[model samples]
Target: MDATVFEQIRLMLWDVDGVLTNGDIFISAEGESFKQFNVKDGVAVALLAKHGVKTGVLSGKQSPALSKRCEQLGLDIVMTGIHNKIAALSAICKELSITPKQVAYIGDDVIDLEVMRHVALTFAPADAHMLIKNEADVVTQASGGRGVAREAAEHLLMSRGLSMDEVYKPLMDAWNATVVVQ
Candidate 1:
């Protein structure tokens, strides 16, 4: 609702199932559930961290895989098995010494609406539930678990005046070098 507050966000809170992964819970015959994650999203989170923007994940379901991924991404916070996401988000804000106006939340389900209301900016993937999309400030063109996170990350970085081309020049040069023939 407050556009000025949304513009000052320095932290991002993400929901795993629908925001980070395609809302699909794949359970093998052995009962092990799996979720697919985009590598680009992982890199985006790392880049955000490098730029001093904190990132965290808050999920209703607890999973070891999610824990592992959060660790791998160097995320500042990871709260799972949280029934009341708003309370969890508030706790994270207090712990980080950040205000509600300095945070953004991304989610895709009904349970996430409460937390979304508290954050300055809310985002939903293109495939998010219609109700969730309605509450979001932005709906990414990419589907959840695909490139949605990357898109959001790029938006944040660009808003802060960070040039993607400049940051990624090394990788781009490497690829160009590989394609060049002697």
Candidate 2:
């Protein structure tokens, strides 16, 4: 919860399965997997973008649903089917011209521990593995697939003395303009 950590966070990396989707995987008879993402979490991603924080995804497994969701969020730095998180993170850091300390990571499993340790800030959903929660700098009250990302986004803004109203004003204005035209 250090304000300095929040201040340093230029990129926010997320773990998809447990951190964003409640760790659930559903497969159809045809062998396609689907994951449900929280709508509020999508808004959180937009809010971060509005506030000048970039977002990315790192997942151990690959899924079309995850890829589509990242596309919708306009996230350009996504890494899926990753085994060596540290190496992936290192590459990301190099590409972005940032250090590990300039990033924040939210994760739920043991696979996330090493990268979580390196980031400026670490967050875990309330229902994350106990070990992950223990390692997190911030353990969100909201569980995964709920409003955890929203909570984290709010925290990010608050740490910088920014308000949600301020962060979302331009987006809301654009939305209002579109609605009024209809």
TM-score of 2: 0.91
In candidate 1, the residue pairs with backbone N, CA or C atoms under 3 Å apart (3 or more residues apart, or in different chains) clash, namely none
- Cα RMSD, model 1: 5.2
Of the candidates shown, which would achieve the greatest lDDT relative to the real structure? 2
Per-residue lDDT tens digits for candidate 2, residues 10-90, read 998899888888888888886547888888787777777766788889889887888888887777589999999999999
- The clash number for model 1 is 0
Off by over 4 Å in 1: 1-7, 161-163, 166-182
Q: Please, what is the TM-score per model?
A: 0.85, 0.91
| Candidate 1 local lDDT, 24-133, one digit each (tens) | 78777766466778887886675566556788899998876777788777788889889988788889989989888899888998888888888888889999999999
